[model samples]
Target: MLPYKNPELPVEDRVTDLLDRMTLPEKAALICHSRMTAGPIGDLPGDLFPSSEELISERGITHFAMMAVPDPVTMATWNNHVQDLAAATRLGIPVTLSSDPRHGWASNPATAHSGGGFSAGPEPIGLAATDDPDLVREFAAMASAELRAVGIRVAFHPMADLATEPRWARISGTFGEDADRAVRMIEAYIAGMQGGTGIGPDSVACMVKHFPGNGPQAGGEDPHFAYGRDAVYPGGMFEHHLRPFDAALAAGSAQVMTCYSIARGIGVREVGASFNRELLTGLLRGRFGFDGVVCTDFNVVTGMEIPGVVSLPPRDWGVEDLDDVAKTALVLNAGADQLGGESDPGLVLAAVSSGAVPAERIDEAVRRILRDKFRLGLFENPYVDVDAAAKLVGASRGRELGRRVQARSLVGLKSAAAPVAPARIYVENIDPVIAAGYGEIVSAPEDADLALVRLKAPYDKREGLLESAFHAGSLEFPAEEIDRLRTIAERVPLAVEVYLDRPAVLTPIAEFATVLAGGFGADDDLALDVLTGRAVPPGVLPFDLPRSQRAVEESRADVPFDTADPLYRCGHRCPRA
Candidate 1:
């Protein structure tokens, strides 16, 4: 047996032996990660989407981006099956499975896959609202264990991007607006996922994402769309956004995922972070001393015409004219170790042969990839027990922790006289069965002593295809909705809670509601717990609530807390009596 095949050998020696034995195609495969579905194992026919067997045997791929987390038994079974295929390959390089954050409350399929059997928790914003670094760490640790239980070794999470820009569609996935606070949260997050011992076999390596920070998008548009590609800095505060990433690196994040947005007007080249060598190589690598693997955000190398997403266009931002091969070359030259959302190694293989990208560059990328696999102890035993996985995922302790954290994340923006215990209650957008536990389920506002209304933070509705799904555009609530909320307040004492995906203009509703609350991806029970005084409202505003849309428009996109006369400042919360 080769040295790489010997589990007792030092990881460095094993990695070297593996790299030496790998073919050019195999090396290329290591540097790119393609998407994989979790379910009963079957072949997915596409150039980009291939079955686990095809990915290992034919393509020589060793990394996969996973989604739609199935039951733990199914996931573990599928993972073990994939491992078996890799075991049959020449090098037997085990697959490093990765997934977006799965436990978030406002889980966008684009951002976080469903929780499946895992404990569902608040979004990053909600967790940050609690202002508890220890809680964040606990959640990350629990999430890490759940991820590892199902045979996933990588957590593409702790999205350290600051929610500086209020309208950015991805803000719900972020820690919040303050750089200092975000840095602290990020450090705790990395430590939790990687563990105190650092990223070893027991740990699920965290990919601190959208490096250099993905906040500060121009007009609050996300980079997933061609129209939203340029991430501008009108206040010239680009370095301010780097605080969290810098802290994350110091905390020893195992990987960095570059964003799709191009840094415009920052004296840097106007190219996507994936295509910009200066940002990826010079700033992140040279200046910041990040030696970890840098993976590109999804679909940077190829054009994707997603069904029902005609409006987004392709995410090729700066190098739109480049062919797939050239795009692959550019991404590699920019120092990205892996092409996320891309499966086909042929483009990279062609680029190397044509001398568009050097073989040494590919070798360098593969070394980092292989080292991570070795560090994860995948070479020793890549398989997991399905029965064990079933028991571990969504374990009772994790669910209890999740529940406590959820209750702690509720921020009371305003406080009023508490409704008497067992008072008649009218609830909207809440499960009636759950509301019944709190009080009598009244049929009308007139019959209720208190009306509880839950609203999503306002977004300007977009037209046609893809834009409609994102919570972007305007931040103001519709007039009719506000009027209705006001009417309810007139009839009965009202408690209004906003599910804040982004900072909303809430002056209208705030004026009318007797009590105001805000949270991110919280369950009805948690909110009710806080409302009924069963749990204290321990959360504070993670980011400032702007007074109006005009303030949001006038504020610099790159700076936190820049909105004029914010209705409620960061850290503001109504005190418990």
Candidate 2:
């Protein structure tokens, strides 16, 4: 066996053996992280891109991020087939499969996918609301096991970025707005995902994301769009944002994904964190000493056009004018190890051929990437057991734990003196069948003894398919909806629960709600269980509940707890009845 394929050799020696043998094209392919859709053994869907076999053979690509969540048996079979393709390659480098967080309820195609066959739980914000590091660690450990079952070796999760900006669309993925709490949670998360001893056969490498922090978006807009490209630090809390990442590194996180926003007023160049040399190299590598794989946020090298719905521009940010090859060169020069969401290895090859990017830089990136694959034990056995995957993917224990956590993460904003078990209950945005389990499901509030209302935190509808997925814009409910809610509250006592994807201006809802609760990626059954007092919610506010839209606008996006007269402060929780 070759030194690189030897399981007993040191990881460094294995990496060196592989790096020395790799060609320029192979090296370029190793650094370009692309996406793949799951399908049957020989027939894989590409949506709009090339097939998995074509990418492996023609492009020489070995790294892929999975976009969909199929059943365990199918996923495992697909993964094994892909590994077989990689094995047939010139170097036979094992394919490393990565995925966005697939255990959560928040289903944004651009960010996180829904828990299809995995244990379904609350979003990261729900975990933050619970304020328990042990629980976070447990969740990560469970998730790691499930991921490894289907051959997914990397987790693009434990989003260490703080939800400092209440209006930010990606807040659901973060650990609230506090630096200290986020640091603690992140440390525990990394420890759990990496199985405490660090990346190994049983471990799923954690790619703690949006380095230097992605939460302080200007106007609370996401950096994914052109309008939301600027990540401004008005409160000068740039260093504060790095706290969780510092903790992640300390806890042995295996990878880091840079944000897409053009960071403004933080001393570095006004470009996306992935393209900025000072931020990626000087700060992340130099000051913090993070030597792990540094991957760019998806599609930083080129703009993507999603047919007729929307023409999404490339998030090159400050370097928008540069060609795809130049942008690829710039990202490598800035010290990133991989170009995520990019399929074309030609960009990397062209950059090297034109002498704009040095071959040594490509080698440096390949070494880090190879080292991680080796540490993950992918070199020894890349294929997962198809039969074992079905039995292990979503075990009963993990599902029960997820259900319990979903209930526990529900924050009680207002509580009744005792659990209200009304004979007749009216419901909205809640399953009537589930409501019937607690009490008689009524047609209207007037006919019922109590009314149960479930609401999603309000967001103005955007035009595109991808744009609409992000729940951005206003946080306030429409005036008509508020008036409708008020009418119901006047007729019958109202129990209101809002899914706090982003911090909503809940002052009006508070006035009418007899019992107000906040949820993060919870199901109707879980929400109703807490509402009817079958389950006890022990969560607190992860972030401040801003009083109004005006207050949210006035608050600094970069600073936590800056809102004037918030409805509830961070960590606020009502006493359990």
Candidate 3:
């Protein structure tokens, strides 16, 4: 057997030998990670681009970011089949599987998959609300075990970008606005996911994201569309945003992903971080000393067009003038080891043939890729036991822990004079059976002693297909919704539970409700537990609740704790009974 295949050999020796044996096509395959949807073993969904056999056997692609798997056993079987395909190649290199966050209730296909067949609980923002590093560590550790049980080696998560801009659509995914608190959360997160030994088959390698920081989008616009492309640093607080990533690196995160936002007014060239050599190579790789795999966010090389529905031309933010080959060369030279969501490796081979990219640059990228796989022990054992997957994934103990964390992470803004176990209760968007356990369920608000209402944070409501999906635009509630809440409050004492996907203006609702609680992707049962004093609420505000929309507009996009006259300040919560 070759030295590269020998488990006993040093990791450096194995990586070096594998790099020498790899051809340009093979090397390109290692550096390109494609998107896949989970389904039956050896069979892929129709929506997925490029067939499974074509990518693995013909293109030599190995890394896959899987989404929408129905169950644990099927996911494990699919992984085994994908690995079997890679093993059939001439060199028999094993595949490394990755996944977006799938342990939460928020199921955005592009961002996070549904926690169906796995532990489902509050999102990361909820974890931040707890503000307990020990709890965050425990959550990540359990999540890591479940991910590895299903053959997922990489966790493309712990979105470390600070949620400074309250209107940004991705705020629900972050550790919140305070840099120091986010830094502590980052350390605990990496520790839990990687464990003490770090980056082994037993560990799930974490890809800490949006390097240099993705928060502070100008006017809270996302970088996904042309309208939301600018990231202005008016306060010159760019370094403050980098604190979480710095903390994550110190904790030994194995991978980092660059954001799509094109930065402006802060020193380096105003381009996408993925294409900016100074930011990716000089700042991150040079000053920060990040030698781990640096992957692009998604689809930087190819432009996407959905025809009348949603059209996103390529995300080559600074270099839109350049063609596809030039763009590919620029990304490689900028120090990106892998292209996320890109299926074709031939584009890279073409760039090398045109002399647009040096052959040595490919070697550097492939070396990092091979080293990560070797460190993960993928070559020794890539297949998972399909039967054991169901037993291990979302095991009873793990789910119970997730529930406890969910209960602990609920933040009560205002509590009623007494516990909310009224004789007659009217509930909206809550399980009727659960409410029955506390009081008699009634249909009319007038007859009920208390009215329980659940609502999502408000947004401006963009009309375009893709634009509307992202919760961008105004952060204030509409007049009609505000009126409705007022009417409900007038009829009966109200208990309002608002989902803090982003910081929202809640002055009107606060005025009416006898009790108000803020939740970040938390379940109704947890809210009930906190209200009835069955469990003590253990969460705090991860960010400030602006008094009004005017305050949010006045706050600088790049600065944290800048909002004035906040209704509820960061780290503030109603006292426990």
Every model's TM-score: 0.97, 0.98, 0.97
Local accuracy of candidate 3 as per-residue lDDT tens digits, 1-577 = 8999999999999999988998889998888888766677555444435667888999898998885677898889888888889999999999888988888767665677766488866788888888889988998899888888888999898888999888899888898988888888888988898894368877888899988788999889888777777888899998888889888888899999989989899888888988889999999999999898999988888865434445556777878898887888889989899988787888899889999889999999998888889888899999999888899788898888888778767888877664446888888989998878878989999998888888888988887666677888787899998898798888988888888889988888888888788888767788876655456667888999999888889999999988898999999887663
TM-score of candidate 1 versus the correct structure, residues matched by position: 0.97
Q: Model 2 TM-score?
A: 0.98
- 133 Cα displacement, candidate 1 (Å): 1.2
Alpha carbon deviation, residue 25, candidate 3 (Å): 0.9
lDDT, candidate 2, 1-577, per-residue tens = 9998889899999899989998888898899898888877654433565778799988889888998869999999989999999999988998999999999888888899886599988998898888898998898888888899998989998898888888899999998988888888888888888998478888999999998788999998998998999888889988888889888888899999999998898777898888899999999999989888999999998876655445667888888888898899899999999999888888999999999998888888999999899988888899899899899878899898888778778999987743367899999998777778888888988998888889999998998878989999899999999999999989988888999999999899899788889999787988887777666678878999999999999999889899999999999886673
Q: Count the backbone clashes (under 3 Å) in each candidate.
A: 0, 0, 1
Question: What is candidate 2's CA lDDT for residue 9?
Answer: 90
Candidate 3 to truth, TM: 0.97
lDDT of 1: 0.85
Which of 2 and 3 is the better model by TM-score? 2
Candidate that would win on TM-score: 2
- Write the candidate numbers in order of decreasing lDDT: 2, 1, 3
